[model samples]
Target: MLGVEAQKSPKGKWTMPPFDPRFPNQNQIHNCYQNFLDYHRCVKAMSRCGQSSQLCEYYFRVYRLLCPLSWVQRWNQQIQDGPFAGKI
Candidate 1:
């Protein structure tokens, strides 16, 4: 079931990404990028600590919700090609 963060449009499309206290500004570009980085960082940290990657789902969900598909694809390609500038 969708949480309170989920809103339905008049056409019945489900909207995503509840408000995040950490990124309160109108533009969500930074928030999206941060969540993507956070998801990778969380995965890396969890793997290093021998913990479950499932714990990072929140970050994954947020990024997936906010980021455009092309941007994500490009970022992923950058990651694979070793050109990603993010610390993670």
Candidate 2:
């Protein structure tokens, strides 16, 4: 099952989402952001670069990109409400 409702986005935690289950870190928030970027790149490349996608892949890209944006919106509320406000 999708773990959204049951799992908070680490907004109030000492850590953050996308936390590495392997090696430990006190600041997993940064890592989560990094991973989000990496995955975005992969999705872009796969959908727009080497290969092209049909309607399904297009939908997939939209859904995937929204994940990080959701995280940013949820965790870094100030960032969204600050400089880059209303741009994305």
Q: What TM-score goes with each of the models? A: 0.79, 0.34
For residues 20-72, what per-residue lDDT tens digits would candidate 2 score against the true structure? 55427664454545454454445456666666423233223333433455664
Note the residue pairs that clash in candidate 1: none
Quote the positional error of residue 62 for candidate 1 in Å: 0.4
User: In candidate 1, what are the lDDT values of residues 1-88, reduced to their tens digit?
Assistant: 1223331112323367788998898899999999989988988898999998777777777887788878987887888889889999
TM-score of 1: 0.79
lDDT of each: 0.78, 0.42
- Count clashes in each candidate, considering only residues at least 3 apart in sequence or on different chains: 0, 0
- Show model 2 residue runs off by greater than 4 Å: 1-23, 50-71, 74-88
Per-candidate RMSD vs. true structure?
A: 7.9, 10.5
